[model samples]
Each structure stands twice: as structure tokens, then as C-alpha cells.
Target chain A: MRPDWIAVDWGTSRLRAWAMGAEGVLAEAQSAEGMARLDEGGFEIALLRLIWPWLDEGQAVPVVICGMAGARRGWHEAPYRMLPCAPVDPQSLVPVAAEDARISVRIVPGLAQSRPADVMRGEETQIAGALAVLGDFDGVICLPGTHSKWVQVSASEVVSFRSFLTGELFALLSEQSVLRQGLVGEGWDADVFLAAVSDGMSHPQKLGSKLFALRAEGLLQDLPPASARARLSGLLIGLELVGARSYWLGQPVVLVADEGLAERYAAALAAQGVQARLLPARACTLGGLAAAIGQLTTAVSGTGRKA
Target chain B: MRPDWIAVDWGTSRLRAWAMGAEGVLAEAQSAEGMARLDEGGFEIALLRLIWPWLDEGQAVPVVICGMAGARRGWHEAPYRMLPCAPVDPQSLVPVAAEDARISVRIVPGLAQSRPADVMRGEETQIAGALAVLGDFDGVICLPGTHSKWVQVSASEVVSFRSFLTGELFALLSEQSVLRQGLVGEGWDADVFLAAVSDGMSHPQKLGSKLFALRAEGLLQDLPPASARARLSGLLIGLELVGARSYWLGQPVVLVADEGLAERYAAALAAQGVQARLLPARACTLGGLAAAIGQLTTAVSGTGRKA
Candidate 1:
């Protein structure tokens, strides 16, 4: 099951790779050795460890990489392409000098916007994939994760975008802060979540004061761990929605995330009378990588590979 | 000089004690063995480690304790006294069983409000001390720390209060989050702090989005560590002020905090045309302890000790 090319998504905490042939994926591999764990020299070593079995005897396999692996401190610096431009450009792919003779690697540049000053790495590829699948996306695309991003698209180009630390805040507060004492289980309550979301959205200014309520309720009324966790999540997402109201208000919204997160976001939006289109994150990643591969095939004459 | 009794301010991180004579505090000592570090049996050992030298051969020394020392998990559970009541009542003090005959420890009961579900441990003593010295205070008293509290007072009773996790949020975001990469030093920019305060108060809803700007500015424009720290503090404090506007807007505010935190809160309030009267935190703690001591002296036939 040897492959002609490879698709890699190297992020902060984990790495995922796919071996590609003319038709579709032949094999897939992943590792916990993401960009954060790798130094400048560690990237090639980590990549070779996963894809060594797929390499041909003497042929160089073209590898298209996306995400933090292209960061300044990753395998090689792939400077971000300024936004108000297409999501991915094959001409801007930066090549890495790998010690292995069978490896030929090129990284997709991330997107950067000035003025308010923001940047995105792997999401650009995902957006490109979404555009590819949807034909042409005209509204906002939301990629929810540790750092959730809301992007505006027009005419196959990313117009503007904003990133929120809502997920990170929720994680820190629920796991590390005083609130951690109350949020202890995997139990969840949708009713409590929706109530908290409404509270957070309507009175965003009271966030600081409201956080302590979880702890107080646990001590006074014996609030359950699941309810506390749900409330904490709802509060942060609700606050995020208030900040991103301009992006989704009166506009078509699409969420690129897994089932659980997608359902939570969809329900939150539904409360405000907004319906969002859902796309699986893994599909979008592959689609984006395939779109970039199409651009690479167009540039190189004898590759004989279809994207 | 031999002391008549002892005063204790035992909190989560540190424990402070004063050897009090009939006139005033003769000598003071502190230790890192706070309630968090000490188990049920460890509190007596920690307290004795600091005050052993002051104990006489046979006389039982009256020790008045405030703060987390009176918590349910502390050495002895001095249950919270419901609000609309006086801050300190020596008659309500819960006595602890100490192995040593020379020690007679009684913990001051903390304050609790039912409607909004709020609780205060050490701050009640501080309010008691502030009221003892001020004769009578009718406005709000702001005590800033890990959990900053805004207490409304009427006549000599605590009317109502609210607590904000602003200080805790600032610590977590500046030291543990991704923004920590940009905040490293103790150098603060007052102008930058003020501007961020304005931004936070004006658009409290955008807090989740605004936090990422500190990191973005650092990556794109080389924002200094001090400025990042200042901005983070200002933003959290500004948001707190918004939630607590009903307590401070057009109302007199008395801040019971150390010089550094008091100055920051005062500056933030000044930006909103509110001038807060500052009182040293230690003084308030001592004052509250002294007020409780007076009640103790009146209730018991004194060994010639005056509060």
C-alpha cells in the first residue's frame, strides 16, 4: 500500500497524517508528537517515524503539510500570507530541506490580518476545503476549538476573522480555578447549560461576579458536579456569542467541528433563532489538504496525481 | 513585654499573628502554614510554631482568629453568620479544643447572604475593624484580593455584598494561559493600563476576543511584558467595576487593600470619576480583631486587658 503523496496536519498538541494514492487515502497515521513537542530538528525525525513504511525504495514522495509545523519555530518558517486573499496558494508553499532522500515536503502558509492584528494556521486549509466542498461560501465559517475562530468569506476569499479564547477560559476555570472544586464529573444538564448561556449573554458584564456563584452554590445548595461543568461551559460560550454577534447575526452560519461541540454550538445558536450548517472537522481537513494537493498537481507537470 | 492575648489572620496562603498587650500590638509574626496547607490536626501545630514563645507557663491566653481559620474545613468549623447582622460578635465565636492548656482559641464566624448566595470569611473581620475605627460607614467597602469583595454597609450592619473573581482571573490568565508568553516582567505602563480599562468597561462583552489581542500584538509588534501585564490587570478590574457599578457609582467607596492593589483600584476608579478612600488592609484586620476582643473583654471578667 505504498502512496504517491502525503497529507499532514501538524498542530500544537497532536499530529495526523494520511498516505494518498491516485484515487483516495491508502493509509492514515497519527502521533502525539505535535509541533509543540518538536524543536527545529525534531520535525523531520517525527515525520519520518510515521511515514517511513509508506516511502518507496528510491522515489521522493511529495508531502503537503499544514498548520503549526510551518510556524517560525517548526520544521521551517513559512511566513503567513496576508489575508483578503484566497485561503490556500500552491505558489506560496515553502519547501523544507529533509535529510531523508525519499522525502519532499512543502508547507502551506498561514493567514494573517493587520489592523486588529490576528493570525490563523491550520484553519486556512480547513476554510479552503469548505469552499471547495460548498462550491462558494459567502457567510461566516466557525471553527470551534481551544481557540475558536469566526471567519467571514466573500467570493472565495477570506475577508476578516476573529478568534476567541472561550474554550481555553472554560478549561482553565473549570479545571484549575476555585470553580474546580465543584466541577468534578462527566455529567451534563442541557437545561442548566441553556439557562447559564442566557445569563452570560444578557449580562456579560457580570462574568467576574457570576463565576464565584458556581463555587458558592456548590457549598450552599450542594450543586452537582455535572451542573457546574455545564454552567461553566455555557457561560463562556454565551459570552463568546455576545462578542461574535456581528459575525453570525442575520447571516448564514456554518460550523466546522465534531458532533458534540457542533451540537452545543448549534443549540446555543438555535436559542437566538439562528440555524447553522454543520461540517465534520476531519472531512474539512482532508478536503482542504486535497484542495492544496490539486494546486500542487497543477504546478508540477509529471506528478500524474488527481486531487 | 509579655502579651495579654493574641490575634490571628489565617488565610489560604499565609497566616499572620499579633501578640497583643493591653495597649496595642507588642510584637507580630507570620508563617506560610495557612489553612490550605494545614489539615485538621496541623492548624494547632502551625499556630503554636508561631506563638509558642509568647505563651506563659500556666495562664490560658485568649486567641481571636478570623478568616479561613474559621471555615468548615479549618481547625474548627465556625459556621457563617447570616447577614443583616453585625460583622463581629464575640458571643457568637465558636471555641476550638486545643491540647495545650495555655491556649484558648475562638474563631470569628464569617458572613453569608442568602438572596444572591455570597460568603465572606476574613473580609468580615476587616469590615468590622473598618467600622470600629470609622465609627459608622454607610457606603460600600471594597476588599481586593484573590476574591475581591464589594460590601454595602448601612448604619453598623452589612446590608449586602458581591464577590468577583477578577484577581483570580488575572492571575490565571497572566501566568498560566497562552498570554503568559507575553507577560514576564514587573514593569507596568499606567497609560496602557488606563486605555485597556476604558476598553473593558465600554465593551465588556468583547472580553473573550480582546484577551487574544495581547498575544497577537506581542507576536506582530513585540509588545512588552509589562504592558501585557498592565493590560490584563486593567481589563479584569474594569470588567469587575462594571458588575459592581451599583455598589460604587455615585456612592462613597472605601478600599481595604494593601498599598499596591489599593493604588490600582483607586486609579481605575478615578478614570470613572470615583475617588475611593484607601485604608491599609493590615490595619483593618487588626481593627476587626480588636473589635472582637472588646466584646470578649466585656463578656468575660478581664485579666486587666483593654481592646
Candidate 2:
């Protein structure tokens, strides 16, 4: 299939790109060279090395990027669209003029919340893609990762959302704190995890005490490393769920994240009697970026200008 | 003032010793050789190095040791005395024999609460010291540190306690987490701190979301580093107070910690309409150790058994 455009999900530490032909992806490429590593002038060079195989020699390839690559400090300054707005808007896309005419790129703008002062960059694209799958869905979307977000979407608009430091807390507690003394790097204990989750959901305020208990048990009762690790993960997740109860309770929920993280969130939600529809994180990003690409394609085709 | 005995507080990273004469401390010395850096036999060597100059030739100068030096993994296994018991029981002291007869050492046992599986080695001695000043007072004792503890004391007996990782969380969040990116660390914003404390106390369940907001506010609102730092500290401390409300509410409260930490706790308490009597940590430790030393002195004078 002949390539129609390109889709890129550029994050802080890593970047992924796909050559989207008329029907589907023709080729794909990835790199560790994300926004964190590259300066303003280096973005084009970095993109070309990965997407060169798909770009026509003279004609410019339309590239829609979604993530930190569009931040103020990133490749281009793509300002945030306020809440109650569409997840992905082609009109809001910030165009970046490259030295080479081989690529025409428009980076997706993120969403910003003022009262609580929260922001989302790459996840907005995922939300747009997930919305595509649900099609005019009025529900909640939960994306679990380093920073887990619970977003309430209504009529293709993000009504309100909250981000939790669940994953980061898990990482710090398991690897850096005294809790690390009892945790193994790998292995899972479902029983211990569930019990701890239940405990956290029941007594969320006692989280600090419970965290130290992981270490105390290790010293007093000789708790196994795997169980401790699982419990740590569970407790943190449970605390997140408790905090996020207002967002997902009695709402149609979608889990948009990687396989493992999605599964963990799904299981945790299941314990609370809430079943969520799981969507691949990649699919959501692709669908969201495709929506942006479609708008550009329609605008360019009608105006006799290439997208 | 000739030296009578030594009062030593041997903790994880630091050690302090005071040469107690008949009336008061004759001299004092300190070292970085804490229990964490020593092995089973290294304890005596470390202790001796700090108190060698105080010991009289061929006479065993009694030394009353407190803190982590009494932990099972510390110098010797000085087991915990169950709660609803005395804070520092001379009868419960774990004896330590020395190759050199110039010093006689006995470690003070810590207090343990079984229901919650909580343990404290050093703080118990602090509690004993605070109790000595309070004189059979029945109320709550708040010791803020790496592990901030709230103990319910009744008639000189430690009834029960809960330990919060408030200080640890503050250290980790301020220095290690993404929140660190926005903290100035030195200046204190009292208004920001109090407001955050109120916010945290009102909705303790939103701790995860609230924590992320600190970083978000930094990014979006360009929150000053000091205010961010103060707010972070306030939020965590407020969360702990909410959890520990059952201990301090409608009861006389005493803040037993270092001058700085105790003052902060006192301020937070005052925000909640609670005035806590501040107890200097050193005074408590010295007074507590002095009581233990007095016990040994009386026992030796009567039963002919050295400390």
C-alpha cells in the first residue's frame, strides 16, 4: 500500500513512529531519541532517520505527532487546550516548519487543568484514539502508567480528569524506601496483593503506617520478598482507586494502557465489582492521531494544498 | 562534677553520649558510628571509642544505652517489651559484657504493639524522657522524624501507637520525586503550608491526586519552589494528622521531637485548634536515660549488681 501519512507518539524517553498508508501501517520505526534527549534543531534530524524509508523523495510526508515532543521545551511549542474540549483537534495542532520539505509535521496539543493544575500531553492522543473505539462514548477512561490518570469523557469531550502518582509511588516504595528490604524485583503473590488492596481501600488513611508494616513484617515475621513486592503494588493501586472512586463509580470505564498495567488495573477494578473495557495503548494513539490526520487530509484536499 | 555514668543514644546513623555525674552531665561526646554501620562485635568497639575517656581505671562506669543499639539486629538482641507497659524498665534492660571492665553497659528495651505489629527502639526512650517531665500524664505523644509516631500513653504506660512515614515521605518527595523539580527547600511558606494542611486534612482520600497536583502546579502556575516545598510538607503532615486524629483529639497532646520538627507539629496542631505542649527531644532523652541510670545506681547500691 502507498503511504498516505505518518503517525508518531513521542514521549519523554522514547519515540515510536508508523507509516500510515491508505488502509493501514506500511512500516514502523522506534527510537530512544525522544524529547528529553533532542534539542529544537535535532527533532527533524531524528525524525528523518526513522521515517526516511517511507517519505517520498520530493513530496512532503504529513506527520502528526502526539506527546511531549510538542511541549514548550520540546521540538515545538504546542500549547495546551483547556478542559471541556475535544481530546484531539486538528485545528489546535501546532505546525512545526522544518528545514527540509520532505516532512510536514503538526504536533498535537495537550490538555491543561487549572484548578488542580494538572496536564496531559501524550495521553490526550490515547484518549482521542480510545474515544474512536468507543465512538461518541460517554464514560470514564483510566490510563495506568508512571502517572495514572482517571478521565471522565462525555460527548467526545473530557469533562474532568485526575492524575495519580500511583506508579511512581510503587517504584519509590519498592526500590528506594525501607519497604525495599522485603521486596523482590520480580514475582507476584495474588493472594497477598488482593488482601493488601482490600486493606488499602478500606483504610486508605493508614497508608503510611501500612507502608512501614511491610518492613516491620519482614523483620518480625520473615515475609517473603515476592509477597512484599505484590503487597506494595497492591496497596499503592488500592489507594489510587480509593482516591479515584468518584470518577469511575457507576460509569462505563475503559482501560487504556500496556497489557500488564491494564491487567493489573482491571483486576483491581474487578475486586471493586467494576468491569472495564480494555484498549491497547497503541491502538488508542493510532486512532487519535488518525483523526487528526483525517482532518488535515480533508482540509488539504479541498484547498489544493498537500497535508 | 566527676562522671558517674554515661547516657548514650545510639541510633541508625548517629550516636551521642553524655558523661553523667552525681548532679548532671560532666562532659559529652558524639560519633557517626551508629548501629547500622556495625556488626555484632563492633558494637562494643564503637561504644567504647566514644566513652573511653569517661571510664575510670579498673572500675566499671555504668552506661545506659538506648535506641537502635538495642534492636535485634543492632548490638545485642534486646527484645521489645509489650505495650500497656512501662516505657523504660530497668528490670528489662539487656546486659552487655565487655572485655574491658572499665565500663558496664545495659541497653534499654523498646516498646512493641502486637495488634498492629508496630515497633520502636529509640522513640520509646524519648517517650520515657517525655513521661518523666509530664509526670504520670495520660494523653498522646507525637514524635516526628523519619517515622513519625503517635503514642497513646496512660499513667506512664504506653497504651498503643501508630507510626506514619511522614518525615520519610517528605524527604523522598522533596528530594527524589518529580515534586523535587519545583521545590526551593529552604524557605517556609506558612500560609501555603497551612492551606495545604487544611486541604489534606479535609480530603485525606485524595492524597495521590493531591501529591501530583504539587508538580502540576509547579509546571502550569509556575509555583514558587519554597511554597511548593512548604505545601508538600504541609500536605503530608496534614494527612498524618487526619489519620492520627483519634489519638490527639479532645486530649492533651505533647510534641516530643527535635526543636524544629516539634514546632512544625505544634503549628499544624494549632491549626486544628489543638495546642500541644512541646517537649525538647534532648531533654526527654537525657531525663529518660537519667532515670534508667538512677535505677542502676540504686540497684547496685542495694543488690550489688552493676548496670
Candidate 3:
């Protein structure tokens, strides 16, 4: 189906797009041609290949893109917008010079913090989308993924945020480190996970020793692969939760993630007496792009300011 | 010079051999033919390739071996000896069926703990060496390497010990993880490292976020590669020191490592008001093997028992 505008979430490893009309998304498309797989000259070709069917013969359809596509190494650098600001500002939209006039592309700028030195790309768009759907969120927004972000929002502005390498560390250790042998195959024990979470939270400093314990347990007591994998995940996530304690403690938490990961997070948080409202990641991404588009339209009409 | 016996330190990634006379080492050789690169049958070949020159035509020289050569996946399963025992025991040594009648090889069994589920193959040999050199010592021994170990020794016996993935984590994060880009080049900042060590000790739970800060700082503040690498090293070591606090606090610490790594650990401990004496790792391995040989000799004469 033909659309008025397009929503593109271009991350490091994957690319997703949605065909948008006056009412809502009319069609969806995706590809593995993410920012990491493309060079400066390859972005236009990749985008054209994906959304060519949806573009009109003469009209230049506005393509709103978010995530790593705006990174310094992406299509074109969209400099990070310092935090204590709106997630997506219409004035900060970086327009691209597409070879094909049928598609006009603009990228969303990521948010950066100075003190603790933190940054986010596509997650900012998700934050904007989540805020749009939630209406007024003045607490914490937790986006769990490879590089998890815990954003503190106040009056529709992102006050501050911290990024944790929990998911990334888990993958590296379980797949590439010495722990790989014992962590092969996947069967999960929920009880083992929760216990490990408690251990991780209580003794986070002993992470190195705790990690080595998985292999030691496997060798000494014949700990199952599934249990070891579960323990590994719990230890990393438990440490992440400890790091993000300041962000979520005494604050309403909204988790932006999919079903499986969100459920694990919810369980981890629930054990700590915090109830998190789960929101699907895809909806938030689409919503964020829609919000950015609305602001862009308003600014072009001479009604909206920079923010 | 002809050797009375041979001492071999066969670890996961490297193999070192010393031709030992009555007084000390006569000639030494090393190769990358570690346990990881050799199977059961291959170990004999690798060992012979390194120390064949030290062997004579008829006499079968006693060859004492330590480290991963005794591991389950190593040359032959020497089987881990349960802890609350001496680092290396004479009776527990597993004699290997070497093809060369010129040399009689025996692998030193590693140590294992049940409750914490920790295991060590080579470090136990180092501890034996350290103890042999510093007689009547009852304190903590810290052996820092790929898997850094902290051992509590009492009356010449290993009461208990723990192994941390500190060195391995440092290698993985600095060389393979996302932080690799920011840590490419050989440079170091001692002050930056000390400060990171302090931070790691105080907030070891915040490791995930602190690690991400290295990348963020590089992007936003142009943090030098040298400083980033130093910071990464400090952070991991600092976390390790914190985890091994119970082993070192109010106890004498003997660090079995080479100069550079030992100095870092010493400085890290000094910051926490603990004084650690540095000992050369090679000397420890040789001494440990020598001690094992002495015990075996004494036992053969029916003077010394199993220990």
C-alpha cells in the first residue's frame, strides 16, 4: 500500500521500516542492511531498495529515520543533542541528499550526557514514542537491550540517563569467553536465575569470581548448561539493575522491550518490589517517528519552535 | 650442561621447560605448545620437542610437570585434588606413560574447592614454589593472570581459595568488545588508572555503566586510547581486589606475578592500606616443581609421607 510518509529504524545490526498513511501504518518492511553493513554511499541504495515499492513516481516521500543511521559512521553524522532536552527535536532533524528525488530522508539526532559520559541513538526515538503513548511520564524509562539505557524524564524532557553493557557483556562472556563451553545450548531455570540475581545484587564486586563459578560449578558439580546460562544472564542483569538503582528506585518505571526480555526484566524488578509497565518496542519506535514527523510538520507550518 | 632432572610448566597457552641440575636450572626453553594446542597423545610430542636435548641416551631423567598439563582436558587427567591440603602433594602426582624411556614424566594435580566451586591447575604449583621459598608463611597468596587466584594458606596447606576472571575480562573487553576501538594503541596513564581503581573499588556494582563511559568519553571528550586502556585495567583489577578483600584484609599478601602485573596489583592493594610483596612467577613455578620433586624423592626414601 502507498503511504504519505515512512518510519525507518536503522540500528547497527538490523533495519526496519513502516509505511505510514493518514490513519496509521499501512505496510511494513525490514532488512539486514543496517548502519553497520552500509558505508556513506550505501545508505541511499539500501533505503531505496527497501522502500522503492512504496514511493510515488514523482512525489518525494519524507523518510524519518532513527538509531545508528544517525551515528558518526552511519549515512551522515547527526550530531548528538545534549541531554536535559526533548528526545526528538524537529529543528535537529538532519536532512540527507538522496540521489533519487522520490524519497526525502531526515535522521533523528541521539541524546548525550556530559557528566557521567553517556549516549543513546535509536532509543531516544523509542523514548519519545513511549512518552507520546503514555501522555505524561515524569519518572524513569528503562530500555533493555544490548546496551541498556535507563533514562530519567521530567516534564517531557530527558534529564539524564545511564547506559549499561549488561546484554553485551552477557553475549561476550557466554559466547566468546572461557565460560562458553558450559553455556552451550539453552534451557533456563527461573529459580536459578532469581538466586543468581540476589547473589549478583548483594556481591556485585565479586563479579569476576562469580562468573568463573559457572565453569567451576559445571566442572565440579555437573551444573546443567541451561542453569549455567540462566545464572550468567541473571548475574549480568542483576548487576545492571544495581547500577540503575538510582534511576528506578522510588520512581515509576516503564520498560520498553519485547515479550520475552520484558518478562525477564519484569520478574527481576518484581522480586525487588518494583512493578514495571511493559510496552512493545516496535510500537514505541513507530510512535517516536510519528511524533518527530508531527513536530517537523508543525515547524514547517511556522507554528512550532525548535523543540 | 646436563640436567639431573627436568621441570616443565605447561599451561593453557604456553609451555616452559627448565633443565635442572643439583643446585638450579642449567638451560631453559619455551614454546607456544600449551595444553590448549595439544591433546593427550600430542602432549608427549610437545614436551619432547622442547626438552629432548636435556634427556640422555639410557638414564630416564625424572620430569616434574605442573599446570594445565594436569587438567581434565589437558595431556592426561591428573584429577584435581580436593583442597584443605598442601598445594602439591608427592603421593597425589599422576605418573604419565611417556613414550620416551629417557624421561619419566608425572603431572602435578590441581586443587579444587567444593563450596565455592573453584579450581586451579598451575597456580597451585606457583603457591608450592612460593611457600618453599618463604618457609613457615601463613597468609594470603595472590596469583594474578588470566584467571587470578586468591588463596588463604595456613600451616603450609591451602585452607581455601577463589579465582577471579579479572585478567580474562580485561583482555576480552580491551581486545574484543566494543571498547576495543577506544583502547587500540600502547600507552598508559598511571594517575587515570589509580582514579579508576578507586572508583571501581567504591562502586564495583556500577562496572557495566562505568565501562560504557570509556566509549562515551572517547566519543564526546576525545579520551586518549592510552588513558582508556589504563582505566580499563585499573577498573578490573580494582574490582578483583575488592572481591578478594576477605583474603588480604589484615593478612600478609605475597603476589606471584611478573614485575609489571605485580606492580599494578601491589599499587592497587597499597591504595587500600595493604602491603603486598612481589615474587617472580617463573621462580615460583620452578620452585613449586622443585618442591614437588623434593617431596617425591623424600617419599621414595620412605622419609616424607604423602605431603
Who wins the DockQ comparison?
A: 1
* Model 2 C-alpha lDDT per residue in residues A1-307, reported as the tens digit of each score: 3478899999877889998987787888999998878998888899888888886666787889999888877998898888988888777789999987888889999998897789888899999889878897999999998789999999789888999998888877777776676886568888888888888888887888888777777767788898988888888888899999999899999999899888888999998999999999998999999988887667667742221
Chain A (candidate 2) TM-score to true chain A: 0.92
As for DockQ, the candidate ahead, 1 or 2, is 1
Candidate 3 chain A: worst 10 consecutive residues by lDDT?
A298-307
lDDT of each: 0.89, 0.85, 0.91
Candidate 2 RMSD to the real structure: 4.0
TM-score of chain A of each: 0.95, 0.92, 0.97
Q: List residue ranges in candidate 1 displaced over 4 A.
A: A52-57, A302-307, B301-307
TM-score of chain B of each: 0.96, 0.93, 0.97
Between candidates 1 and 2, name the one with more favorable lDDT.
Answer: 1
Over B189-301, each residue of candidate 2 has an lDDT whose tens digit, in order, gives 88988898888888777888988998888888998888988888888888899889899999999998888788778999999899999999988999998877777667767
Cα lDDT tens digits for candidate 1, B88-128 = 87788889999999889999988988879888899999999
TM-score of 2: 0.87
Q: For model 3, what is the error of residue B198's alpha carbon versus the real structure, in angstroms, after optimal superposition? A: 1.7
Top candidate when judged by lDDT against the true structure:
3
Query: What's the distance in Å from true for residue B175, model 1?
Result: 0.6
Candidates 1 onward: DockQ, in order: 0.81, 0.60, 0.80
Write one digit per residue (lDDT tens) for candidate 3, span A12-48. 8889999999999898889999887889999889988
Worst 10 residues of 3 chain B by lDDT: B298-307
Question: What would the TM-score be for candidate 3 when compared with the true structure?
Answer: 0.95
